[model samples]
Target: MELDILAEKENVICEMVSNLYRTKSNDDSEIFTSIYNQYKSIHLQYSELSKNNLEALKRGLFIQWYQKTEPNFLSGISDLEQDAEKQIVNNLFTVINTKQVDSELIWMLNYYNSWDWVFLNYENFRRFDTNLVNEANNRLPENIDKKLMLKRGQMGKYWLSLIKYGSTE
Candidate 1:
């Protein structure tokens, strides 16, 4: 009888943990066996106990759940992280293809590299006041606007592409 009760309790704990990742919050008791208040109290007890007795309860929340649950929850989380990283890498490749030598691309490159282009000239323009920019803007001719815009745009894209995809050929 005792063994049966322990098995049932273990099953309940496993179910609660499996549902934890699906639930909106860790405090939600819908996945737990006991009443909400009781579950909350026990949760608090566990948290406090873990904090006070670090040597015994040093394992993190995910580690604790993985240890108790029959399923490999750790692998699931790991796979999710890996898949997200892969998607980011794919998007990075798409950005790399944006650089080209067409007229429009040349214009973009010029716009980005201009001194007046804030993003492209961030190294020089960052922390500079609006007054300084306005002074520079007033002094510069209108045709230079296109050059600044294109230069800034190109430089911004170049640096961003470099950071995300590294030096591309």
Candidate 2:
């Protein structure tokens, strides 16, 4: 399947996970576990395929992790209770660290990781490290239009606010 289509599917699945997490009902744990296991199965299958497929899988996993690890959710769950979540993140880091990835994919992964980090460390953002931001800025494509750059800047600021203050609105 095309990467865009796969990305859309990933988004849908991640949204489902997010909704399950937000529900806070008694059955949420069972439902979340089922969905997460299915996601991991699909992720492992894609990881064994071509680089593009792996990238899509990583992107989807990262999006789900980002949503689930939001400050509000993380406050209630201990890392010891999230073995699967840790494993998924560790797998993503391992893949991104490999030498097999091309420069473009590396840049894209770095951008996504850094953007997600901003949210993952929302409470401690004041003391957050700048290395990821610096790396993302350095990897930015040259000669990009001012409009696109502005949009990216705006997004970063918006995400920062959402992390530090809560809510996108």
lDDT of 2 by residue, 1-169 (tens): 4544443444455557557567767766665555555555444444443344455444434434444455423221122223334444445445545644455445444555555553363332232234333454445343333332223221222234333333322
RMSD (Cα, Å) for all candidates, in order, is: 23.3, 9.6
lDDT string, candidate 1, 1-169, tens digits: 3323322333354455556656647564342334323323333333344333321121122222222232333112111122223332232223334321223323332433343332222222242233322333432122333322222222222233334333323
**Model 1 lDDT-worst window of ten:** 74-83
Clashes of each: 15, 0
What's the lDDT for residue 21 in model 2? Answer: 62
TM per candidate comes to 0.19, 0.40
Error of 2 at 168 (Å): 20
State each model's CA lDDT, in order: 0.30, 0.43
Candidate 1, superposed: residue stretches over 4 Å from native: 24-169
Error of 2 at 104 (Å): 3.7
